[model samples]
Target chain A: MKAALRNPVDFSQFPDANGHFDRYGGRFVAETLMEALHELNEAWRDCRNDPEFLAELDADLAHYVGRPSPLYYAERWSRQLGGARIYLKREDLNHTGAHKINNTVGQALLAKRMGKTRLIAETGAGQHGVASATVAARLGMECVVYMGAEDIQRQALNVYRMRLLGATVQPVTSGSRTLKDALNEALRDWVANVDNTFYMIGTVAGPHPYPLMVREFQAVIGREAREQMLSEYNVLPDALVACVGGGSNAIGLFHPFLNDSEVAIYGVEAAGSGIDTGRHAATLCAGQPGVLHGNRTYLLNDEHGQITETHSVSAGLDYPGVGPEHAWLKDIGRAQYVAITDDEALQGFHDLTRAEGIIPALESSHALAYVTKLAPTMRPDQSIVVNLSGRGDKDIYTVAALEGIQL
Target chain B: MNRITHRFQELRRAGRKVLIPYITAGDPHPELTVPMLHALVAAGADIIELGVPFSDPMADGPVIQKACERALAQGMTPRRVLELVREFRQIDAQTPLVLMGYLNPIERMGHAAFVAAARDAGVDGVLTVDLPPEEAAEPIELMSAAGIAPIFLVAPTSSVERIRRTAQLAQGYLYYVSLKGVTGSAALNVAEVAEKLATIRACTDLPLGVGFGIKDPPTAAAVARIADAVVVGSALVAKMHELADDPERMRREVAAQLAAMRQAMDQAGMPTAFAG
Candidate 1:
């Protein structure tokens, strides 16, 4: 059943000229980075319309990055839930085993066109670090990744992988010694090296151009999913679900479908202990609007506006601030956001592995966890699509240690 | 006139350069901040930058970052920083005070509320590190209405167009980041900074204050030769950290360090008029 409806909100008009999404996103960086951001905005605008640039980006995505990943029907898992048919958007099958590569590949291309010889990024769970290193290696550009010291110790395998890919993994020991700290360190590095360096931000956050640019690069996911649903299944999914930290993957899947008024959108956040316990990374769920990093967004800060520490079993979801679009989306009532506890997410991970023989990343497991709750509330005739954003190969050691097995 | 403008005018008339020293508010100890500020004023600091410690200071290097952490750990908040300002104003009303930090704390307090409170606390100017002139229309308007000057940073990478734009909105003095990095970064190249200052001078008549990497007497002296003011930060902050155990020594030593820079800058004479 197709519904022909005109969307009240036009998605493209967002960030309106100055990169603001209804007062959520703006360039909040220092003056040192202003002209550089302006230049990046200009370059992105130019390349966005250039056929040659599109051709090159398309060629690389098709051949090197492997786009148009398949949409898989999780029949067994859907039957087990017993309420709605479930489909998984297989972003985990892409190169680098996650949705992170989609943005890094595009940004690396843009950096190359801008005549940048170096790429710098900040990573939490190391997926983006690996993706950034992979693109930098392919493009023959020097790469540096700022990772929190705590994360570097936990995700040592990805640290080695990035080093093997010829990227320097700089450990940040400031602030909470986590993703937020890494972002601060990365911004410092960018400020110091703005001339020859391009900051390849890993998410749909930061100041202008970055959130908009990263969203545009990632929108390929929703575009493909929409076309695939119409052509193969003949009906759009009743619900869309994805995990959000800085929200690149979730935004990628949600953007194309935003104009579809009938579609229900859900963004899941990581609730380490619980929301009431104050140890969660659920920024939109439990945060006030404040400025941080480079934009005005909902942030987990105290009464005095100091960024608070966040905890999550999954490193990627442990952030105090979310992408500004998510904050805007939540405020506008266009999308719904919920939280999944670590225990529940772990259960979802095991349930998906056992039921469908799919080893999902812990970050993606949050989305799957929500689907287990939402799918059971809907009719079995309708379908729900959850973005399996990455594979769990990197999490084997973590799961093993939790299960009392030495990997 | 606003105290900042008055101070700059007074210095200009005196053919002397302004020496601005920055210290994190409530650093070392909350009780010692007012004393430290008084000591700085006694040391010939024409204007002072009082740092409101935010947990994340992206524009600052490790030295100031640690200072912020220390301050935050001691329960320093934006309101408390204002209270400190009020205390400092009680004794020394003439030495203009500028609260410098990132924007979140002020944003936490509504812009109007923050501006009104700042005006009440006798804050002469505000320099939000991450806030440029482009996204600052509302705050700039609010601060201007409250009779408080809105200070802005002009970086080495700032374009001529940007300089003109910032110069239009800015009051008090424009803080010129002497290098291409965060506060307390590498040494500044004087010729490079001088050339940039000339470009900036072409845009407006706002008095210029140079900061970032003006570590000691010699560097401050070098900067005083080319700019209207020499603003020193990390050197004093690092000095404070060294004497954190002794608040009396911390105040005296930090003041002595600033006094040395002031002496050196005074010996350098008034900066040669911008060649623009």
Candidate 2:
């Protein structure tokens, strides 16, 4: 049976006045950073609408980042599913080999306009670190990235890549020694250097301006995909699928099509073992709403409000909190969120590699895993677009090691 | 009168500066926490700031962060820390005790409920690390109604407008983060702090308590000479961290450091809260 597609609906104005998407996503930082957030919000509000800023961003997106990343029809994978036709939005072709650069370029430009000379960011998989470093190098600014020591050991290739781009990767050995701890270090750095440094938050999380600002910057993915679908098949995708870590790529792809009631959206989270067994990053699915890293969102925390350690095979998806806007979306029934276990996502990696001859980042495999379940249930005429967020070259070693082969 | 106001008002009448010391409620060892509070008072502390262990303490540096980790390892909760505070109040009733921590635990307990529990726990005040004045209206009002002074931090990076707002909302002494870095990082600069305090002084008549990077007696004395109070945490917590195996030695060593800093402040002609 096919799902009904409703007609187009008007986009609702959210995050009103105070940057809140409903009851979530407000500014909950220290007093010292209140001034800085205000400054960034004002600068972003002015630049987001300005012709000069948008032109520079557009020019850079076209010439520098190689924008309009092709929407490739995964013909072989579609045949293997024997159901809905699947198309891949190739965000992996972007500079830095991931969708992260889309927002970094815009934020680096904003940092320049704000007159900040330094950039700081936190990374778990080092994808965002590489993107941040690339933009910082392009802008000729000093860049420092905080990564958990445990992550630095796993993502050694990206650590080296970030350093090659003239950026410093600081290892955070505190707490769980992962993305959450790295974010704590980054927040501490921002509080101390609030005068001159700009914190380039990688995901659509953090305080007020960051969620809204990063979403707007990365929204180009969905905007381009929407037009390309019309230009190619003359129809909107029946369903859109993307992985949600801190949910930057997912939100980017989902934001533009939010008002299209006909388009069904799904966000896949990395459930390391599984949600019922605990130790998963499926905040929206299993976790409760709480405050972490300056925003009220669904978080994986213990009974005493202590943020619990999260586990995921994909370093990029190993966060305890999801983006606040996703929380609002979940509550308002605009999109659906699901969790895919490590074994399922690993199967996704293998299937995509063999079928489409395209290796996806482990983070992207979660989305692919969901599509396997989703695609088989739909008709051949129905189509689905999956945001292939990044390439899997970084995960080759991890895959080999998991098979007991030393690379 | 409330303990914080009474302590400050008594200091003003006596023409003396205030000296406060900070220690994590469960650091080194959970059982030793209330004992250390008593020892700090015995070492001439006019007020105390008890740190509530949080999972992610963004404002703290390495030492204090490690301290929180050790505290959490011993299974410290807001309710347990309140029990410890209640036990400490059994022996000492005069020295003002302020609970300092992040906003999550209190948010979990709800604004009205947490404020009421804190007042019942013999807590004199509360300073939530991440709750700025702009977002602190409800908590401030609840604390005020509960008779628990709502404290706030004013950093050197704060604008005059922010300082004014913080001072207006803050009921107890204003915590002046003497340096731009976290609690345990950076070196203290007296001249820069003095300059910033001049701007803060113009904004409010609230007693200013200087903290961050004040590790030694001389630095504590220097800040005491210029500001109304000196609050030291990381250095003292580091000492407790070093003597983790021996709670008595950690207590004695930490108390000794506080005593020496207090003597240095007095030797520099800064009167104690009880002296003129």
User: Which candidate's DockQ is highest?
Assistant: 1
Model 1 steric clash pairs: none
Q: Which stretches of candidate 2 lie over 4 Å from their true place?
A: A1-12, B269-276
List TM-scores of chain B, every candidate.
Answer: 0.97, 0.96
Per-residue lDDT of model 2, residues A131-220, tens digit only: 999999998999999999999999999999999999999999999999999999999999889889999999999998899999998899
Per-residue lDDT tens digits of candidate 1, residues A263-370?
999999999899999999999999999999999999999998999999998999999999999999999999999999999999999999999999999999999999
Question: lDDT of candidate 1?
Answer: 0.93
Best by lDDT: 1
Q: Which ranges in model 1 have alpha carbons more than 4 Å from their true place? A: A1-6, B270-276
lDDT of 1 by residue, B112-157 (tens): 9999999999999999988888889999999998889999999988
- Candidate 2: residue pairs that collide: none
Worst 10 residues of 2 chain A by lDDT: A1-10
lDDT of 2: 0.91
